[model samples]
Target: MKKIPVYLFLFLLLAGCSLSNVQHNEELEDAIYLIVSDENNDKLSLNSMTTFDWDKAYLFTPYSTQESITEQLGVDFKDPSDIDWRDDIYLLVFLDSDQVIQYAELERQGADFSIGEKQYLTPTDDIINIKHD
Candidate 1:
């Protein structure tokens, strides 16, 4: 009976330690953002894309851009590992100070750009014009 309790305690302790690897960021500190399923969002490399990772997900925070992505390659994400993200465009998510979340896709149409259709978490009466430089 004593060994049973000790094993139970050890199992619980190890399980808690294993759960520590889970990462989650609930706050945003930037005007533009991108979320993807990958670590190393540290901006360690420029234009260096990492391989697809389904084990973990990461979000790019506080990003702004002057250029844009005008076109997007149609993808069904059938094989997430094989999905090719648009290098010229980004799915910029705007989280206003009011915590109003808007989904916008930035596209680079030559020298000009456009923001994708706006979406909201809840119904809002205000116009959402999420612009970037």
Candidate 2:
């Protein structure tokens, strides 16, 4: 009877550990972002881009332009048609203030590149723009 109780306790402890590991892996896979540049090869400014959410990922620069914010800190910019979904690179950006978190993935389809689904640390509405040089 004593051994039976011990075995049950061990089984429960192992199950809890496994569950934690799975959750940690999931978070790692979702924490990624990409950096986008402008025509002049300069990073876009974050002033023009919308604030980021800490819990969700964002597509920083969807298009290349000369007038848009050329530099951003938390946003991940990419060309939607140039990404390879199966072989996409993963990236993660930590906001300076610790308020916003960015994640990104690239997916390539035929002649087009697409960004994969992103997971942010927070909602989009909760992000505030931070200036950078």
Candidate 3:
């Protein structure tokens, strides 16, 4: 009846809202360029995954602490706010196929860094190697 139709409409509306709010992580294969930040706040552009040291890479979740990120990046911060993602941290920037820039905070592991929020680790050295122009 009318009550059933109203309930159905309300359910669809809520479902659509929730779906829209959910963020979808971009696939690594969709990324064209990987930009990394150095300790001096300098940026390095890696056009291909081959340039990245993958043997020492690992995957980490985004649920990390400010202290942990600071320690991993080998930077000192008296306050969490003192940590700048653009400079004081190791960030892995992914320029996706859709021209959308996605980023993840990186934690150094010896010679290589672990990417955060990435689900799987694949040998990407040979996949996409387009240099950023």
Among the numbered candidates, top TM-score falls to 1
In Å, residue 55's CA in model 1 sits off its true spot by 7.2
Model 1 Cα displacement at 56 (Å)?
Answer: 7.4
Q: Per-residue lDDT of 1-133 in model 2, one digit per residue for the tens?
A: 3456888999999997754321112233322112231122223222224243234333433333322211443333332233222233323333434333333332211212223343322333333222222
lDDT of 1 by residue, 22-102 (tens): 222223212123422122232222112222122111111123222211112121111111113434443433233332132
Give each model's whole-structure lDDT. Answer: 0.28, 0.33, 0.35
Q: Which candidate is the best by lDDT?
A: 3
Off by over 4 Å in 2: 1-4, 23-133
lDDT minimum window of 10 residues, candidate 3: 124-133
Q: How well does candidate 3 score on lDDT at residue 76? A: 35
Query: How large is the C-alpha RMSD of every model relative to the true structure?
Result: 16.8, 13.8, 14.1
Model 2 score (lDDT): 0.33
Q: Count the clashes in each prediction.
A: 8, 37, 0
